[model samples]
Target: MSEFADRIRPHAPTRDDASARRWIYVPYDRLTDATGPLTEQPASQTGIVMMEALAKAHRRPYHKKKLALILASQRHFALKQARRGIKIIYEFTPGIFADGLEQATRHHRLSALTMMQPAEREMSLDVEEARVRGIPLQLVEDTTWCSTESDFDSVFAPTTKHFLMDRFYRRMRQKTGILMQPNGEPIGGKYSYDAENRRPYRGQPPVPERPRFHPDSITQEALHLVAREFPSHFGTLDGFDLPVTQAQADEAWSFALEHLLPHFGPFEDAMAHNEPDLFHSRLSALINISRLLPRRLIDDVARAAHSERIPLASAEGFIRQILGWREFMRHLHRRTDGYRQLPGQRNNSSSDDPYAGAEPSALNAHRPLPAAFWGRRSGLHCLDTVIDQVWREGWSHHITRLMVLSNLSTLLGVSPRALTDWFWIAYIDAYDWVVEPNVLGMSTFADNGLTATKPYVSGAAYIHRMSDYCGHCRYNPRKATGDASCPFTSLYWSFLDRNADNLSSNPRMSMPYVTLRKKPASELNELRKRAAQAIEELCHAQQASPQE
Candidate 1:
């Protein structure tokens, strides 16, 4: 037996006389699958294992709310299982996940181990480790996801090129018969209502307040453990009210369908001060943890739309997020091998810097991420507001994440890996499989256009038009070089100019290239100088005050 197996000590078993032959390892993310192997075998013949691997928690200094949610939800699920007359072994250890699993198997004297295939590669690696140590581990299909790996492969295998999300989304709609007419066409004569979903909130109908759940004693205990262990982590525990049970999750879902779904379409992209979740369903954390399943949620939304309880646009928009983007991202992550290519691979020889010849300097991708990312004020209204909300709530809607945080980071040329790490550590819904494809592929265009047809970079003009962030900002969105010039505006021109060689030939970027060429050499030089100065100042501020 391994050294880790020596730490085998069962804290709680459902029954002392139960003869357990198989152990089911229940990861925190798959907390709701009670019908799997747990139900296949007799309760007395089965054992469920839940672990609090402290080393894994400390990997990247996750947000306090994220930590609380995962731990609390896992503990609650374990207790729920215990009440169901199922044998369970809960392990709290400072060692790794594999060690915890090995300990559980040995402590219970189990003959076989079975687990639902984990969504994350890291968790999968732990299972592989156990198998190598002579433990018989059976990997079952993870029923949490709406689509399986085979489903993704079946659609993309016939095509040689990179898979586009829109095409895949249409396939999913057809496959699932969601939002479809009786004749097998999309409802409302179109597959997407994205154009209808961009209307800004002018404070007309008023945004409804979302329901909040108070933490019970079990959740409070989980909060205390996280606070004691990760005192210095990002985010706060003050407003930690995420749902930890299936009933609580169902109530939250019902609340969204009733009050928020009506306006969810039009104002989905809009952002305002003090509005962290404008008409958006704050269900990602719950869905991620299996408190709410994706297929059930999609079916509920579709039924509501069909019955005229919600608008077709609203239902389609919500469905697209889950069925289209979320599913597409997972498939893309698996397809691209998590986008593990070098930064320069996408740049062509014609687009390379004249000074650097045929190769772009690796230094372009090595810039350190600034402290403003961790809630420090950058004196930029939009950035400060978004970061502050993340520090307090561990979440922000997709638009702010894409347009404000990600767009600015791309303009500043922050290392893609650094930004990816920050997002994974900061968000309550973040998992490696999701964050990597989003931050590197769509948000930053760091994979150069693998997922996005064009980079999502924009000047302050787009920001000012889409949001109320510019109303109170000190910088002028119109200016690109003055003292009060918006950093986004300056960097916008500079980003286009600096990468002109690489981007000029792309047909989608032709208009931006034409505008870049229209600018005088002096103006272009000035924009570059101003952009460099702004980045330097931001970096200096971060160094001076490491914490906000």
Candidate 2:
């Protein structure tokens, strides 16, 4: 037997029974769904398997807080199950998930292992591997998500066209009866309050103090373990304060509703210096871990809004994130065969341009991701501050993510897969399913405009307007060349000039193309030169930095 298999021994319900009939393998993310197996079998007959797969953690250098959060949350959940008289088998192993499962099956003498379908593609494959190895594993439906595979099939079966999120979102709203009127119309006579949600924060009404949970013994132990095991990880463990238990997660959610939700909508796109989390709910880790259910949270928000406490815009905005974007992304993942059927390109070739028809087998972006992305100072205040926050806290609001980091990477022509991997490793909330679609499709437009209608590229002006980062930075948002020029300003025009052949035909890009056409040839060439220089300087800086 392997050393990993040796470490996969059972920890609780230390009975010497060699004939335990049923067992449930509860992956860390499916802590709440374990209720299904817990209710079906007696506590004595039911054994729960939770593993700390060290091999998985080292796949990418993850944020320390992210590592601590998952480990602590899993340990706490296992302890709770053990307290409820369920047999718990918590394993720590540096091996493939299949090895752990095989060892677990033997240690418990499990006749059958029940598990809810995994949310991630990789984990689902691991379960398949276990089945091929002859473990009697039974996969059940994942009830945590409001939508299911059948629901996705029903929505997509009618058409061979690309899945649009708005239509799917409306279908979900109607199906769930959430944020809808009695007559089946949307509340406030609109399906989206997005137009009302983009006001910049002028620092007038004071932002609420973020709620923090002191690390208890359980969390402290998990923190120490992570520090020792993954000392070279990206983030620091100085202020690790994420909630680990169900009660703590509930408390954090309550704090958001009371103090932040009312202002969450208007400032949802706003960013500020020293304010890493402005009005955003930091409940993603909790929600992903199953400590909080999305449906329940949505229902609670709607209920509070109905009482005239939460504004319609705030409630609508928040609900749109969950009911609309979150569900839409998951269903889109299910309906599409990975990147094989991405938007404009069919059979890896575009129908419009015969010359530009061939899609690269790899991501189109060939530029190396800057070392500044891993917390090195890039001198650009917005990027530097956001990276710093991620290294320290493993969190940053969506605006910083989309408008700043993603926009910069897209502008610089950074590889979509490289950027996606960085996001998965850096953020506490990131997973492959979540990060891949958001990064490749929405952020980079590397999926050829499948997820986003247009590439989310912006000149520094947009960043300056939306955030206070420009106020303190040395670069000029308006200047497109010279020493004080913002790289974003030069790159924006260069991006338009470079991709004009592909984008000129796009109706949505007509205005930018017209502007591009009006610009003098000399000016456009200067902009391109400046963009090349900026990219070269960034690459050089990264190359000079000591490797992490």
TM values, all candidates: 0.91, 0.92
Question: CA shift at 326, candidate 2, in angstroms?
Answer: 1.2
lDDT by residue (tens digit), candidate 2, 1-548 = 43223323334645454355367788878767334566686666666888988887887788888999998888888777776667677776798787798887777667777888787766877787788998888998778888876766777764545555777788888899998888999988999989898888888568888778898877888898899989988788998888888888889999999888988898888898956688899888788777888999899999988997899999988998888788777666555543445544555434453212223222257577888886667889889999888888888888899989889888887877667778888899887567767776778877766666778888998998888888889999888888789999998888777777766787888898898889898888888888998888775564422127
Clashing pairs in 1: 351-501
Count clashing residue pairs in model 1.
Answer: 1
* Candidate 2: pairs in clash: none
Residue 134, candidate 1: C-alpha displacement in angstroms? 2.3
User: Model 2 residue 434 lDDT?
Assistant: 71
Q: Who wins the lDDT comparison?
A: 1
Over 1-548, each residue of candidate 1 has an lDDT whose tens digit, in order, gives: 32222322332553343244467888888888545667686765666788989988987778899999998888778776666656667787798788887787777666677888878766766777778877767899887788888778777773435557888899899999999998999999999999999977777567787778899877888798888888888788998888888778889999999999988998888888856688999899888878898999999999999999999999999999999899889878666545543233644224332211122222255466777886566889999999888888899999999999988888888877777878888899998778888887788876667677888899999888888888889998888897789989888888887777767787999998898889998998888888998888665454422123
By summed lDDT, the worst window of 10 consecutive residues in model 2 runs over: 354-363
